[model samples]
Target chain A: MARVVVDVMLKPEILDPQGQAVANALPRLGVTDVSSVRIGRRIEIDFTGEADLDRAREIADKLLANPVIEDYEVRLVEGAEVA
Target chain B: MARVVVDVMLKPEILDPQGQAVANALPRLGVTDVSSVRIGRRIEIDFTGEADLDRAREIADKLLANPVIEDYEVRLVEGAEVA
Candidate 1:
């Protein structure tokens, strides 16, 4: 099986409150060096046949990512151990 | 500034309904070769100074991932362009 990874992240201009919350809470955990945090989605698509970047990109574009506020990158994972 | 990436995924045995939902919908998009889909979280932590893998791991373990069902990997991003 071939595995593809899609990483969907918010646009740089977008405000990520969830990440901010985590960043804000870090002080309580004594983590003072961290300046910022941004949270996104990582999707793993396992193909029954060959790893198809175009097909994966189509899937990511149509289903996984919101183009209005998010950006996504799709790439093939070579020899990546299954989680 | 340096960035650390933490990818948090559910254990292989855990049920991923969100991923399943996406996979089920793919057929409508003319995607049939896909065998499975798993969704997870990708977190980016930017530090004011150096990229600290140990600190990032601690934050992931304590707040980001549920040790019971999730597995996380932490790594430093070298010369990774900002999103």
Candidate 2:
């Protein structure tokens, strides 16, 4: 099995209200000294034996993320050995 | 200004309650056929002239993420023209 990491975020040109909300909430959470903050989503998947890297990317692009408003990337990392 | 994208996710071995909740909510959102889902965070920042890529990375590692339970990646993408 291969581990794939997916990152999904808003495009730079777009305003991110969700990120702004998080940033505003930080100080309330007692996290101070933060000048700014933006929020996005990350997803990690363990591909079954039949899935390859290309297939994983396809999954990310097609269903995992919205290409118009968001950008995403997939990184393949080595997984643990099967005992 | 340089555009930096940060992706924060739970460590693969750790159980992600947030991810699980999001996954469970997907079908209700009318998104079906998803076998699984793992939720995470993505942050994008436009580094001011003073902040370099390395500095942005430092911020991500030190403040933007919880190093113990989460892992993050920083990607530097070219920004638009200043003019």
**Clash pairs for candidate 2:** A40-B41, A40-B42, A41-B42, A42-B40
Candidate 2 scores a chain A TM-score of: 0.75
lDDT of 2 by residue, B1-83 (tens): 55567778777787887667755665554544444456778786654453356655676676677999888878776653422
Give the residue spans of candidate 2 off by over 4 A. A21-38, A50-54, A61-63, A66-68, A74-83, B18-37, B50-54, B61-63, B73-83
Best by lDDT: 1
| Local accuracy of candidate 2 as per-residue lDDT tens digits, A15-49 | 88866765566555554444445677777655445
Model-by-model DockQ, in order: 0.94, 0.27
Writing each residue's lDDT as its tens digit, candidate 1 over A1-83 gives 89999999999899999999999999999999998899999999999988899999999999999999999999889997654
Candidate 1 error regions (>4 Å): none
- Tell me the TM-score of chain B in each candidate: 0.95, 0.75
TM-scores for all predictions: 0.97, 0.55
